[model samples]
Target: MTPAPFFYSIFGLYLNSNLAIPGLIVLPSVSKVDVQVSFNEFPPALQTNIELKQKIWWVSRYKDENDRPLVTIWQLENGDYWRWEYGDRTEFIIDRKGTQIWANWPNNLTLEDTVTYLLGPIFGFVLRLRGVVCLHASAVAIEDKSIAILGPAGAGKSTTAAAFAQAGFAILSDDIVPILERDNHFLVQPAYPRLRLWPTSVKALYGEEDALPCLTPNWDKRFLDLTQPKYKFQELPLPLGVIYILSDRTTSPSAPFLERIPSNNGLISLISNTYANNLLDKKMRATEFDLLSRVLAKVPLRRVTPHADSENISKLCDVILEDFHKLSNNV
Candidate 1:
């Protein structure tokens, strides 16, 4: 059977994949989809196995310079080779060029589970291979400004962005936010129209915990479906206004607040918030540092601590908007 190609757009690029990607926007044939990939029976494989050093693992169980490994990398004679054992009976093999990914899974495994992991961190790694500076952040467009919300896991980057959505702000991207440099400016490229949220965030936003569909069947995490025509996702690149690194209230003062980060510290924070940054090699790290230097010099950066309860997200949004205007007027 000749499987018709499925076309979608994401991360400011067109994608033509062999399988249907749910929650992705389909475009006409005349539309441009730059990157092409396929999920077929067999893709070209390495002729021979070379030495592979354990780059990263499924879990950081130990730190003895070498130990248990899950996701391993091998510099094949032809190109880069990656192997992932996701433990859900799902596995993946990705080529060096970031153009192809081969998935393997147990027969009983749900398709949702396979696609979830594949698209999340696995595909983020592929984007890293393609040299996109992916950030662990979410963004919203306000007054034509791309305000990126940066934070570590559980820091409410997506949750905060979802609040912006509830407040009638258009979401730009969530989770893996890709940034591109063009014409001497840093631009936050628009991604797909989906925002993943936890049960608590879903309930807080929609008042119905189970209103939206799960990101994957086995996962409790739900996502905002922008395809409904109601939630409009920003579709073009916008020059970044500032990257607000979020801090938990437990570690912050009583009330929500924002603080300016020194340029040097901002550079460090930028590197720390980068998506899949741990996988960067020495050369890649050097390039990343250079990019960060330029970005920090050009774009504004700040740190924000939201109220502990997190119920009144509107207040936090108000503080951010106030500061954004202050910064913008000064600039």
Candidate 2:
């Protein structure tokens, strides 16, 4: 007998897939499915589609031993699907409608490696196609509202969320934050219940690097399990209360500091840190700009500069919670 598909909900969409996403929380059974994931074989339509005018859509910053881009995308002329190639081992074809994904990978390539690509950029691209404005940020629940932690890679977005989780706060999302506009408020859609951290971060948070299990055997990165009793994962969408842009860590402060950023600068930061930004078209950029402009009018954007000392992480979380309290009292 054939095995049943796995069911999960993330970024407010019900996912039904033949391949189980390890860190994502699984649901028993769902009546509605928003996205379907298939691993059988590549669809014929992808090969038959004519090349679009812009055949090459994106290239990863990372490179292979041959010095070529590790990941390259070929945007099909058919406008029906986008093909993503990661290294030489894995490839995924995503439909333009964001409703289906077809994936292929060699057995030599660890399943975790394929899942790393799927759960990160692949799913982020799907959310973009579905008209959700996504940010390269992490979100955590504070009181009744959500706080979005925005930064480039290595800027402590996930680390900050993990720190909050250790303090009993609920993590709304990690890495890619999906934003939805409803009436006058912008809400945050939760991602999976896992936080990927560098070994250094794990050591800082848990007293040792081995405190959490390695995300994959080939990777030194460890992941914090939010499903564990001590941690929390927020499932419901919460209204965004603030956006905190993390600046470079400094040594002088010995503590994290927060300041309100100018609206113009905040908008620029939002555009720069948007998820799957390299693949967005002019129309998508325009929509994102408009939506974020309105969000700035209501939600404040602040800059946070943290101490370089990894041990000061708890102090960082304390500063953010205090800021949230002030924001709440003012309202």
Which residues of candidate 2, in runs, are more than 4 Å off? 1-4, 47-54
lDDT of 1 by residue, 166-285 (tens): 777888888888888898888888877889889888887778889878987667999887666656788888888888999867534555888889876787888999988877877667
Residue runs of model 1 more than 4 Å from their true location after superposition: 1-4, 30-33, 46-78, 251-254
RMSD of each: 3.8, 2.4
Candidate 1 lDDT for residue 237: 84
State every prediction's TM-score relative to the real structure: 0.87, 0.94
C-alpha lDDT score of every prediction, in listed order:
0.75, 0.87
Output the TM-score of candidate 2: 0.94
- Best candidate (score: TM-score): 2
**Candidate 1 has which clashing residue pairs, if any?**
14-33
Instruction: Please provide, for model 2 over 76-130, each residue's C-alpha lDDT reduced to its tens digit, 9 standing for 90 to 100.
Output: 6557778888775688888888988888888777778778888899999999888
Which candidate number would show the highest lDDT if scored against the true structure? 2
